[model samples]
Target: MHGRIRTWGPGALVLLPTVLLLGYFVYGLIAWTFNTSLTDKHNARPVPTNHVGFENYVNLFGEERFLNSLKNLGVLTVAFIVGTLIFGLIWALLLEKGVPGEGIFRSVFLFPMAVSMIASGVVWGWLLNPSQGDDARGLNRLFSILHLNFLENPWWTGGSRWTTMASIALPAVWQLSGYIMALFLAGFRGIPPELREAARVDGASEFKLYRYVLFPQLSPIALSALIILGHMSLKLFDLIYAITGPNQFRTEVPSVYMWNTLLRSDMAKAAAIAIVLLAVVAVLVIPYVAYTVRQENEE
Candidate 1:
């Protein structure tokens, strides 16, 4: 016992404080937020120290803004995830053709991924500005020049609910599709050349080869992208805030709602929003984590 303790003691001593800090600061913070959500501790509540027990959640769900934000999130999540995956898969497949300037093309595609979403939002917000009068700018100018003025519409601001959400998704897809492309590309390249040759040897056509062999191999990559992008879309904030500036337009998402709620000192409602968002993220993440662990175990 003494010898074993001596051997492992230093590592335990090093890990203990860090683990305790994380448990308190991170997990404890989450627990506190959950507790806060159960209270009526802000704004005009008479007894501020009382636990209201989900009244905040009931009030939050009844709000039109909250419902709209949820709808907007759904739109953004679908558009962003579908667009990124399809475009990314397309880019990956095209690059897998061993085209000339492969490195340059790959770098060009991936460069946007390195750009911050806030920066992307700023640039896209300018480019897709809907104003066509004296403030005619970016794509509106080009559209006017090309006589395609009909295509010029509100980009990320003030539009049909779904339209605005889809507009915001465009920049998101543009920025992150490259990363998804990289993921799929790596998955594609990881497939052995022998598998392709054998498929060909068996009289498999190119489409058949890919449909039967290649796609199944990319399932893990697809799952990873789906989970990553889904969580991101659910938690989207910085980009929307940067571009939209708390306008509460059709593009407003949950994170923006939470921010505005907190600003109004509706602590309980804001915490409820946060907790709901966290639950959503958890719904995505926990499954992914379980799948990953299961994969590792099977391996």
Candidate 2:
């Protein structure tokens, strides 16, 4: 027993630094943020601030901008997820059905996944500029060349609030659809040809086979995509901010809200927002992580 302990102790010592760093820097910071949220911390004040006990939270909820940010988040998240999932599934299915140049198509579709959201947003911002006439740009230019003016609309800057949020999601969907496609493609390939053949022999048509059997088998893949895309969309800040540049009229989300709030010395409000954001993330992530861990343990 003593010898066994000694043997693993060295390895434990080696890993201790990383474990301590994670526990302190990661979790400790989260704990501090939560603590800060419970108080009335202001950058304008001295180093120490007085306890306010959820006043910041109440105030945050009362703010019109914060509420609008929440609404925009919901709009963007749903639009991005559904659009990406459907588009990816369709592309993956087409590729699986034997396209003329499958490898080339796969590479092309996956290329967007390699680009950063910031870069995609910048490019798409240029493409989606809502200006008209002499200053018409982005996809509007394409619409003009193709004589498809009907298809052109104010992408990020024009339209109703919900529509504007959904427009912001378009670039995100385009960027992420390729990743979702890769996920679906892998899921499809992982499915056994023998299983498909058995279904065929059982007199199931192509549509029915996929509708019943293959679709059910791909549930895990779909769930994985949902979890990933949901996480990305919920906490999104960089892309939207980079493209829109703090456009208060539209395209604001909680993280950006928090950033602006913190910048203005509203530390308590920012921390409250951060805590709320963490809660949302935890709600999405905890279940998935637990499920994955359980599956691994069972396996």
Candidate 3:
């Protein structure tokens, strides 16, 4: 025991502050938020008092707006993940093939990631503006000039709810596709060139080589990206807020709902919504973390 303490004591001391800070600020806040969700607190008194159990959560589920937010989240998550992965993989494959201006193109693809989500939202909001006739602007104006007026229509402001959510997802995909491309490109580069040669020598066509060998090797990278994107989608807020603002129910998500609920002094309901978001993120992330840890241990 003495020998063990002598070896580890200094390291433990050095990590103590960081551990305490995480304990208080991270897990501690999660516990506090969960506790608040179980109470009957309101804006006038944001503190928890009457223990109402899961009443707030029950009521949260009953709310039409909350249900709609969940549906919007589902639509956004599917569109964002599928669109990003497809586009990212395509970019990675094109880059791997040694296209001309490869270095410049890679930098151009990644530039959007340098811009903030709010900025992308503002820009896309204008591009997708649905105005027409004399009032037309953005894409509508461009389409009018090109005489392809049929392509222009109301984006998030006036559209089918699912389509609106998917439209909102486009900006997110544009922002993150480059990062995903880098992940995929790194995965491709990490595989030994000999694997490609072996597959080619075995009479495999180029498409078959990628389909049978390279793509399978990228499963780990894909899973990691899926988890990351899934969690981000579940907690999405800022971009939607910047584009649709708080009133656009078609684009409303749980985070936005929580903000609106909190503003209305419904503290318990907002806490409940927050806890729901946290639970969803945990559901997506915990499995990936476990899979990663198990793989590390096996290796």
Candidate 3 lDDT (Cα, whole model)? Answer: 0.90
lDDT of 2 by residue, 102-201 (tens): 9999999889888988888788778887865556787887887788877778887778877798888888888889889999999999999999999999
Best by lDDT: 3
TM-score of 1: 0.93
Estimate the TM-score of every prediction: 0.93, 0.94, 0.96
Q: Which candidate, 1 or 3, would have the higher lDDT against the true structure? A: 3
What is the lDDT, from 0 to 100, of the residue 184 in candidate 3? 97
Ranking by TM-score: 3, 2, 1
Residue-level lDDT tens digits of model 1 in 22-95: 99998999999999999887775676478988898898889898888888898899999999999999999999
* Residue-by-residue lDDT tens digits, candidate 3, 137-208: 988899889999887778777768777887899899999999999999999999999999999899999989
Report the backbone clash tally of model 1. 0
Report model 2's TM-score to 2 decimal places. Answer: 0.94
Which is better, 2 or 3, measured by TM-score? 3
lDDT, candidate 1, equals: 0.89
Report lDDT (CA) for all predictions. Answer: 0.89, 0.88, 0.90
| Candidate 3 displacement at residue 9 in angstroms | 1.9
Count of clashing residue pairs in every prediction: 0, 1, 0
